[model samples]
Target chain A: MLAKRIIPCLDIKDGRTVKGVNFEGLRDAGDPVELARRYAKEGADELVFLDITATKEKRKTLVKLVEKIALELDIPFTVGGGIGSVEEIADLLHAGADKVSLNSAIVRNPDLINEASRQFGSQCIVAAVDAKSQGDQWEVFISGGSKNTGKNALKWIKEVEERGAGEILLTSMDRDGTKSGFDLELLSAVNDITSIPVIASGGAGTSQHCIDAIKKAKADAVLAASIFHFQEIEIHDLKEKLKNADIPVRETI
Target chain B: MIAIINYEAGNLASVSNALQRLTIPHTITNKESELDKADGIIFPGVGHATPAMASLRENGLDSWLKQTTKPVLGICLGMQLFYESSEEGDSEGLGVIPGRLKKFDSSQHKVPHMGWNTFSDVNAHPLVKGFGTEEYFYYVHSYYAPENEFTTASCHYINEFSSVVCRDNYMGVQFHPEKSGKEGSLLLQNFIQIVSSE
Candidate 1:
C-alpha cells in the first residue's frame, strides 16, 4: 500500500521563510534552504515552498532559493505562489522543483491547467484550493484566502481535475492556525468527489490531527506549517504516531 | 563524460542536478556524434510511451542508442522504451530488454502508480552497491514492464512489477532515481562511481 505523506510547508518571502497566524502577521522562521535541509533530515516526506511575496523581486528570489534548496536537500519539494504561465512553471521546474503548484493563476485562467498539464505532464501540476465554510457550503477562496470565488469547492475541484490538475492541495481557511484539527467535513466532501491525490492542509496542530485527517477525512497526504515550523511537533515523531495508527509512512533512518 | 539522452521529458534538470551534486561530469544531448564520445549513457524520460518512442525514432536516437556498448541506464519512460513494446500507444520499444510494457489495471489497484515504493534485495551490482534492500525510491508511471530474466529488483504495485532490470551493459529502472531523495542520489552516485571506475 502507498504510504500517507507528511509534508512541512515553508512559506518563503524574500528568500526567508515567514510563518503567520491564520496567514497574517508574518514572522521569520529561518533560511529557506537550511530549514528545508533540516526537515529533510528529520524525515519529512516532502517540503512545500510557498513564495508568499507576490512581487516580481520576491518571485526571482524564490526561484533562486529553490535552486539553492535543490542543491542541498534530497527530498521532494514543491514551489508555488505567483506562478502564472507555462514559462514560469518551466523556470521553477528547471530550478529543481519536483512540482509547480497553481492557485490564483488557475482561478483566473482555468485553461492554464490544461496547457500546463499538456506541456509538463499532469503529475507535476498541483491545483491548490483555499476553502472556507459559508453556512451549508464550502466556498473556494483565492489570493491566499483573501477573496471569495463564489464557486463551490467540490465543483471547482472536479473542474480542475478534468482540466488536468494532477493533485489537489485543499487548505481550510477556517481551520488554519486554529490548532483544532483539520476540517474533516470539508475534507471528506472534497475527497469524495475527486479521484486525484488530495493533500490536506491547514489546522494540523498535533500528530493525532494528521492521523485523524487520513483516517477520517480519507486524505492521501497531510500538510502543516505552524506545527512543523514552530517545532511544536517534529516530523519524525508525528510520522511515528501516524504509523502506530496504521497509516503507512516511509521508514525513517 | 556521461551522456543523458534528452528527448523533451520531465525531470531532466533533477537528473543533471543530481549528477552535478556528485561532481560528476556529464552532458545532455540527442546528437549521435556527441553521444558516441560518452563513456556511459543515461536515457531519462517522463511522458506517454508511444510518443516518447516516436520522438526517439524521429530523432534517430533509436539506432544510435542500440549501438552503444558503454553502460546505459533508462529511468521511467526510458526504462519502458527499452522494452519490446508498450500498450500506451501500442508502440514498439527499443527491445534492448525482452518484455512488454502494459497499463496497470485500475480495477486491481490504481493507474499511474506514483510516489515512493520500496525495492527488494538487489544482487551485487555496481548500481545497487551503496543502497540497501529495503530502500525506497520515487516512482511515477502509468504502464510497467512485467518482471523477466533481466529484472534486478522488484516492487509490488497490486502485483510485482519490474523495478530494476539489468542485462549486459544495459540497465533500466521503472522508478526515477533522480527525484527519489537520498536513496535516489546514492543510486546515481553509485552509477557515477561505476562509470568512473570503468
Candidate 2:
C-alpha cells in the first residue's frame, strides 16, 4: 500500500520563500533552498516550490534555486509557476526538478499538458487546478488564483487526466490562506471523478485538519503552507498524529 | 567508474545525483564503448516495458550490455527487462533471469502498486548490505516478476513478487532507490562499495 504523502508548499518570489495573506501582503520566509533542505530533513514526503513572481529575473533565480535544492535534498520535489513551454519543463528537469506543474499555460493551451506527458512520461507532469465555488459549480481559476478561467474545475481535471497528466494538485482559492480547514466539498467532488492521485492543498489549520482531508476527501496527499511555514504544527508531530490515526506515513528517523 | 545506461527513460538524473552525492565517480552514457570502459554499470529506467526494451535494442545497448563482465544493477523497468518476458506489452526481456513478469491482479489490491513496501530478506547479498530482514523500499510498478530461483528478496503486493534478484554479476531491484530516501541512498552506497571492492 502507498503511504499518504505530506507536502510543504513554498511560495517563491525572487528566489526567496514568501507567504502572504490571501495571496497578497507577502512576508519573506527565508531563502528557498535553505527552507527546502530543512523540510527534507524534517521528513517532508515532498516539496512544492511555486514561483509567485512573474519577472524574468525571478524566473532565472528560481532555476538556480531549484538546482540548489536538487543538489541538497534526496526527496522528490516539484516546481511550478509561470511555466509556459515543454522546453521550460525540460530545462527545469535538467536543473533538478522531479516534476513540473502547469497552471496558466494549461488553461491557455490544454494541448501542452498532453504533448508534455507524451514526450516526457506522465509521472513527470502535474496539472494544478485552482478552484472556487461559483454558484453551484466550482470554476477553475488561473494566474495565482486571481483570475477565473470560466472553466469547470471537475471537467478540466478530467480533460487534463485524459490528456495524460499523472497527478492532479487541487487547491481551493476560497480556502487558501484561511487556515480554517481543507475545502472538503471541493476535494470530494474531484476525488469522486478522478482515479489519479489527488493532492489536497490550501486551508490546513491543525494536524486534525490534515487527517480529515485525507480520510474524508480521499486525498492521496495533503499540502499545506501557512501552518507549516509559521511553525504552528511541526511536520514530524503531525505525521505522528496521522500515523496514530491509522493513516500510513513515512517513518521519521 | 559507474555507467548508467540511458535508454530514453526518466529518473536518470536522480540516480546520477545519488552517485554524485556519495562522491562516487559515474558517467551517464548509451554508447557501447563508454559502458564497456566502466568498472560497474547501473541500468536505471522508468516507463513501460515494450518501448524501453525497444530503445535498448535500437541503440544496440542490449547486446553490448550482455557481453560486459562488470557488475550490473537494474532499477524498476531495468529490473523487469532482466526477466525472460513481461506481460506489460507481451514483450520479451533480456532473459538474464529465468522468470516472467506479470501484472498484479487488481482484484486483490490496487494497480500500479505505488509507495513503500517491505521486503523479506531471503538471502544476504552485497547490494542490500545495511538493509534489515524486513526493510521498506519505494516501489511503483503494475507488473512484477514472480518469485523464482534467483530471487534474493520477496515482497507482497497482491501476492509475493521478486523484490530483489541476484545472479553471478547481475543484480536488479524492483524499487527506485534514488527516490526512496535515506535507506534507499544507503542501498545505492552499498552497491557502489560492492562495485569498488570488485
Query: What are the chain B TM-scores of all models?
Result: 0.95, 0.96
Isolated chain A: TM-score per model? 0.94, 0.94
**Which tens-of-lDDT digit does each residue in A88-122 have in candidate 1?**
99889888888989998999999999999887787
Please, what are the lDDT tens digits per residue for candidate 2 over residues B8-98?
7646778888888888889999899898789999998777777788889999998987777789999988988888998877999899889
lDDT of 1 at A215: 99
* Candidate 2 per-residue C-alpha lDDT over A152-205 given as tens digits, one digit per residue, 9 for 90 to 100: 999999999889887899999889889889999999889888867789998999
Best by DockQ: 1
What would the per-residue lDDT of candidate 1 be over residues B108-170, giving only the tens digit for each residue?
543457677787646667778766556777777778889888888888877788888888888
Q: True contacts preserved, each candidate? A: 0.32, 0.29
The CA lDDT at B89 in model 2 is 74
The worst-scoring run of ten residues by lDDT in candidate 1 chain B lies at B106-115
Candidate 2 has an lDDT of: 0.83
Highest TM-score: which candidate? 1
